[model samples]
Target: MTTLIAEDLLLLLLDDVKGTPTSSYLDVALGGALLLELALAEAVHVRERTSVWSSAKVDVAPGAVVSDPVLADALGRVAERERAASDLVTRLGKGTRDALTARLAERGVLRREDDRVLGLFPRTRWPEADGRHEDEIRARLTAVLVQGLDPDPRTGALVALLHAVGAAPSAVDRGGVPARDVRRRAKEVAEGTWAAKAVRDAITASTAAMSAVMAATTAAAAAGS
Candidate 1:
């Protein structure tokens, strides 16, 4: 079974049968997942002892051979210099969703079909090919959010990602996990050590930054309207 965080995040973003993402939020969320994966793998990180989170230096762990082309590319860019978590999130998020979708399709979890936008511009659609694996993933999240069970590091990270992207409600709806419980338990997971302290700190800072950007955008749109 492909147990990469990216794979799991992709599964959650996509429908079990349709294989389509629940929303555009999946894009940035998956980018956060990628950075978390690097943190978990000790491949990249933000510096410690920085008074400000935004100005903290982001660096790749020395000598890590990231196998995924997408990851490798990200590492190369992130390694170039230090940047704020929000800045890195914006930079790292580019291309992550499509890369993960391709990876999932390669694993047979989904299949890509040629299509067109409005029956005009060329497009591609990913439909679910297999669901058992994703079902297992959902079951674990169910256990955590509904059963009040302690999640393993991987599951914990997934819980954090789902909540980070505002998908927690839908993710737990099938099992009827309460929104309150989802928020409470998801906090525990996010606070838990799914990775090194440095990595965990990075995830927290990055997600917060992303949320702020979303809020500001919404406020700006409201004002404009």
Candidate 2:
């Protein structure tokens, strides 16, 4: 089965050697990726806000059949009621990492490693089992973000998600390109006039929501520390 964009994003954020995620805001990014995938699949529609004060509204596309269980579950949740795209990011993304990671492990793209931190706290890690697929994904990202090539919808959507999570600069090797230049390029692609207005609005809402979630998480962690 073809991997979802969310899966790809998770793979990118995960450290291949340590089998741990590089980003703290992974769930938010994963949720945003699912929304974007649903948008691309036409399984859901994100209506543009009618006014500046209104949020982008999300609605399930009637009779949309999502073959993947992960997406199907998200589509079902979306069908429950219309919601602001921003609100659904967290709602739909909740508890998705386990499912996605398990799927990747099942597919042999990753290996499940059960261990303990300091031999005291139990923890699980997913180290790279097969890297060919991730290498291909990185190649595509490099082509667009650093090589200045036009991106297809999937690639464009991936870039937008990476940008949302503030990972675009680190997602790929910059080679000769400056990190700022890569970031600027990602921002341009993310905000460019390539996708439909609805898709664009969804991305914008997801980005805002992702940022908010990340901020809250960071603050909470600091407070706890």
Q: Which candidate comes out best when scored by TM-score?
A: 2
Q: Residue 56 error for model 2, in Å? A: 1.7
Local distance difference test values of all predictions, in order: 0.74, 0.89
* Candidate 2 ranges beyond 4 A from true positions: 222-225
Tell me each candidate's TM-score. 0.86, 0.94
**Residue-by-residue lDDT tens digits, candidate 2, 100-189:** 999999999999999999999999999999999999999999999999999888899999999877889888879978999999999999
Highest-lDDT candidate:
2
Count of clashes, each model: 0, 0
lDDT of 1: 0.74
* Candidate 1 C-alpha error for residue 11, in Å: 1.8
With a 3 Å backbone cut-off (N, CA, C), the pairs that clash in candidate 1 are: none
TM-score of 1: 0.86
* Span of ten consecutive residues with least summed lDDT in model 1: 48-57
For the record, the alpha-carbon RMSD of candidate 2 to the native fold, in angstroms, is 1.5
Residues 22-136, model 1: lDDT tens digits: 8666667766777777776778877754564335556777897788777778777787787766677777778877777788788888888887778899877777888788889
